[model samples]
Target: MASWQEIEREFAEFAAKVRARFDAGTNKTIATVRRDGAPRISGTELKFEGGEVTFGMMDGSMKLLDVRRDPRIAVHSPTLEPPADDPGSWPGDAKLAGAAVEVEESPDSPVPGAGYFRIDVTEVSLTYLGVPADHLVIESWDAAKGYRRRVRK
Candidate 1:
């Protein structure tokens, strides 16, 4: 098993991979749960700066509303490979969950629903070709920065 620090490093590396694959385009998806218990999922651009994941939304978007009402989210990265209709030969996918908070918008940015929502990721699970791995439970989170490795009991 990897130590907490090593796991953090792996997460950072994985973030870099995601950024390279999606940050420049529109491929990432954001899923938020509403206070009324509805689930809202939509594609959004993901930006990583100084190790924090930032995603933007229009002020009036349902996702934004959902996050505001219930600031919990699950972000998913679908299998990169083309999905096979058959259950076999499928690629892996990744998902992370955490608490979310609204971020102040940039004064100069003109994107309409340009406000950001930052998620303080608390749990992460990686599925390799549909095999679920052990869940990583976050011991602590920092929205201003990121997460610190938790000491193993």
Candidate 2:
């Protein structure tokens, strides 16, 4: 169990790392499931506001449509880079993953071609990219399985 302050601090640090990566020109992938249950993926810029992560999407876009139709979404910051010398070399960057439930919908969206959608995040997980790996945090809704971490290697 982590304290609120501690969790807040962790999120701040995590957010900074994400911001830096994006600033340096790394694009993240947003994954969402449709009402019919098919997975949809799109590449986009992600912005973090305090603990909230926002996504800007186009109007009439399939991804946006899916999100509107089904708010349940899983946004991941996947490892887009491979190990340098060792195949197992870990970067130690934090990856945030979890469910994002729309909390607000704007009349105007920053997404490439139109309207905006804002969401109140229900669950989130943080994983540190490193060997002897450590999952810094896991937070989720009770009905949604919350957050859990498992190291692959």
Candidate 3:
């Protein structure tokens, strides 16, 4: 797994694009494993600070409990449709997959039992569709493989 800092250091340009997409909106989506091993989706807010991706959850929240029991997580940037007049202008969608590690809460934590987690990214990807006329593009980065690009019609 790699930290956000490591991803930025190795794939600076791509990382920037991904970060921009993630920051384009206030709410993001996170996927976690439920106790029955089924997938659970939750709305979340993300913080990219101090070269780390962090998030908080209310105490005893199901999502928080899920992460506590199983740290694996996948976070998706908010989805935005491309304008009809400017298909290529869309920022595309970004995804980050990793394991969450519980971290100590700051003194200013809003909730008494709020849980904080730092994401240790294992994979990051951006996907663009219909950007270059009937083509789809995907760019991905990983700790072991660095960066890769793929295209489809």
Candidate 4:
């Protein structure tokens, strides 16, 4: 796992693309595991600060409970539609998977008294149309292997 700062320094170009996509909008999707071993998706807003990716959950919320029990988590960047006239112009989307380490609320806690956790990122990826707009491209990075790009028809 790597901290956001580490990603920034190690994969500056890829990290910038991921951050831009995440910053493009507010509401992101978060996936957590439930007690019954099922998956739960929840609307959430992510925070980037002090070189850390963090988020808060309403006190006693199902998401909070899930995080407490199983820190494994995944976050999807806000979505944006490709322009009708230029499908290839779409900025693409980002997703990150990691373990959410419980942390004490920071002094500037966006939601005071809420549950807080910091993401120890295991992987980050972005997907978009290739230059020709006829195929799909996926760029992914992990702590162990660094970076890789794959294309699909």
lDDT of each: 0.58, 0.52, 0.91, 0.93
What does candidate 4's lDDT look like per residue over 1-153, in tens digits? 999999988888999999999999999999999999999999999888889999889887999999999999999999999999999999999999999998887667567558888999999999999999999999999888889999999
Best by TM-score: 4
Error of 4 at 146 (Å): 2.0
RMSD of 4: 1.3
Candidate 1 local lDDT, residue 106: 50
TM-score of each: 0.61, 0.59, 0.94, 0.95
Candidate 2, residues 40-149, lDDT tens digits: the string is: 88886666554556667667778877776777665556444646655344433344444444544543443445535444554444444454333332322222553344
Model 3 alpha-carbon miss at residue 13, Å: 0.3
Give me the runs in candidate 4 sitting further than 4 Å from their true place: 110-113
Whose lDDT is higher: candidate 3's or candidate 4's? 4
TM-score for predicted model 4 compared with the true structure: 0.95
Model 4 Cα shift for residue 52 (angstroms): 1.1
Worst lDDT 10-window in candidate 1: 130-139
